[model samples]
Target: MRIIIAGAGDVGFHLAKLLAYEAHDINIIDMDDDRLQYISNHLDVHTTKGNSTSYRVLEEAQISKADLLIAVTESETTNISTSIIGKHLGAKKTIARVSNTEYIQRKDILDLKDIGIDEVISPESLAAKEIKRLLKESALTDTFDFEKGVLSLVGISIDEESELKDKTLVETAYLNPEYSFITVAILRGEETIIPHGDNKFMLNDHAYFICQPNGVERVLDLAGKQRESIKNLMILGGSKIGIQAARQLSKKYNIKLIEQDRDKCFELADTLPNTMIINGDGRDVELLKEEGIDDMDAFIAVTGNSETNMISSLVAKNHNVPKTISLVENMDYIHLSQNIGVDTMINKKLIAASFIFRYIRKGQVLNLTTIHGVDAEIVEFEVKEGSKILDAELRNLDFPQSALIGGVIRGGKGITARGNFMFEPKDRVVVLSKPECIRKVESYFK
Candidate 1:
């Protein structure tokens, strides 16, 4: 795809990096020469050192012939205006990254789509929604639902107590004889492994499983984790993500929010009537104790500083908080979350990029998502009529070694894909694939 991206900031840079892997014709525009230079030096993309809102700059980037134009500049106004102008300049689709929650919640009133913007993404809102989902399933490191709640992909770490820790994939088959769930991928240290029959689970390995709705608890038990219900949440940072999470989860859980800035704390108190807003430093261990960190079922740190978020989450974990989620903007730090013992780590840029990449995928893919720090993707594809996938059992197919068919949803029933299982036409197949093997995996559905 011939894609033009406005801004060379984190979101735009990350999106460009993802699309560049697919060999897309990417053109990035930015006002800062240094940012543009960084992108050009690191990525195989055309960089234009100019404001994206300028028609002359857009023309220079060949926006008229672009398949998609993404506006993710820091300024919300700039992003919106660039998307609108790019759409008018003949881009087929335009996406604007917005910060204002009102622009997303009140979309019907604003109707930016009618004016040419095709989509509006709010990173903060997306992060908050992710936080809410993580809290709901406190035991799992990651969770993603496919086809509503029919099937889900969950990640859990293997510890010394895990029954499957030293067992190979085939040896653990007896644990779930009903075929309710399947382990798709394993993250050991920094390596992402698409598991096979001989692959044995090890300590500290992050195992990802695809299972039916009722199989969640079974998977948790196999990983030596018990399902915990979270009713008390303490959020550090009054940023958009923290405030949004508090607003959404206040009714369901007891929420206490701490903000370093006194003015922001008062603003949060005004907006979030149900949440207790405290004016104190989240990094202060004494203040956290005084505010009852130990009593919190889940502690979430969404502070702007990555170090602060990480340190505070560690403190919560030290205090025996069952669930600790930290928002780390630096993508490099995400891989350390599981290694350092944090429950979950989130990056708004990565979340937003993955959400947008779903629209770029080809074939019959119904849904697609990338794990927090893992180098693989969970993609759902529909088995089409007369496709080769439906002709034989999974074991007989020439499937990619770097990918695995985790589960299949047939006739609205979720089934864990086994070696003897045969695909049916119209069945939804969820496959976990590495970046290098995604194209090979997608070819079968095509």
Candidate 2:
């Protein structure tokens, strides 16, 4: 596929990196020579230095022959204009990254698709929805539901007291006699392991399990955690993510939002009537103390500065907050969340990239989610008639070492994929695969 990306910023660069791995023909455009140079040096992509909205620049980049054009510049107007112009220039599909929630909320009323924009993505809104999901399942570091909660993939850190902490995968069968779940992947330090029966769980190892909706409590029990209801939340930063989270969660939880700018605080106060908005620096330890940080059940740091978010989340952890979620823009810093003390870390760019990738992938990929700080993806695929996967049991199949079948949803019910499990046509199979094995895994669905 030929893809032209406007902007060499974080979102654009990350998207280019992902597409490059798939061996797609990628062309990146930006005014900054340094960013373009960085992409040229680090990735196998064509870089053009110019204003992306310029017709001459689009023509120079050969946009007329492009299969897709993605506009993710910092400015919303630039993104919209670039997508509209690129679509008119013969691009088959166009996506624009936007910051305003109104664009997404009123997309039908505005008739944006009529003007040639195929899709519009808001990273802030995506991150806010992710925060809300995490809050609902506070015990798990990450949670993704498939087929309207028929199946779920959850990530949890093992503690010393966990039943499966020191036990091998085979030994844990007694914990789930009904075979309601399976341990699909393990993240130990920087390495990702597709586990087998003999693999032993170590303390602090982040384990991912695929299970049915009713099996969530069992998974939490084995992971040494109890489900707790969150009542109070303290959010740092009155940015787009913070404001959106406040708007989404204020009705269910008591929220106190802190912002450094007085004008922004006033704006938040006016917009979020149910939230308590304070005009103060989030990094002020004294101010946090006065705001009763210790009483907050959850602390979310989403400031513009990555370091500020990390530090504030750590401070909340120090104050014994049950959950601490930090918004780290840098993908490299995601690993620090688990290594340090933060409960969860979110990167909006990565979230948006994963969403777009699912849209691009061929076959019956119903959903796809990238694990935070891990080099793998959870893809839900629909089994087709006469596919190789339907020939034999999962353990007998010559599946790639970099991938494993996590679970299957059939007849409106979810079941953990076991050695004896046989694939049937029309079954929704969820597979967790490392980057190198994505193509190989996708072949079965074709």
**Each model's C-alpha lDDT?**
0.88, 0.89
| Each model's Cα RMSD | 2.0, 1.9
Query: 1-446 in candidate 2: lDDT tens per residue?
Result: 99999999888888887788788999999999999999999999999989999999999999999999999899999999999999999999999999988989986689688998998999999999989988977788888899888889998988887898889998998999888888889988888999988999998888999988768889998887888889999999999999999999999999999999998888888999999999898899999999999999999999998889999999998998888899998767878777786788999988887777777874447878888878898988899998889878888888998899989999998988878889888899999998767878988777
Give one digit per residue, the lDDT tens place, for model 1 in 1-446: 89998988888888898788777899999999888889989999999889899999999999999999999898999999999899999999999999998878997788888999998999999999989888768888889888787899999989898999899998998999778888899988778888999999998888999989878889998877888889989999999999899989998999999998988777888899999999999899999999999898899999999889999999999999989999998767877776888778899988988878886674447888888878888888988888878778899998999899989888888888778988888899999988767777877987
Model 2 spans with C-alpha error above 4 angstroms: none
- Quality of model 2 by C-alpha lDDT: 0.89
Clashing pairs in 1: none
Clashes of 1: 0
How many Å off is the CA of 438 in candidate 2?
1.5
Candidate 2 to truth, TM: 0.94
TM-score list, all predictions: 0.94, 0.94
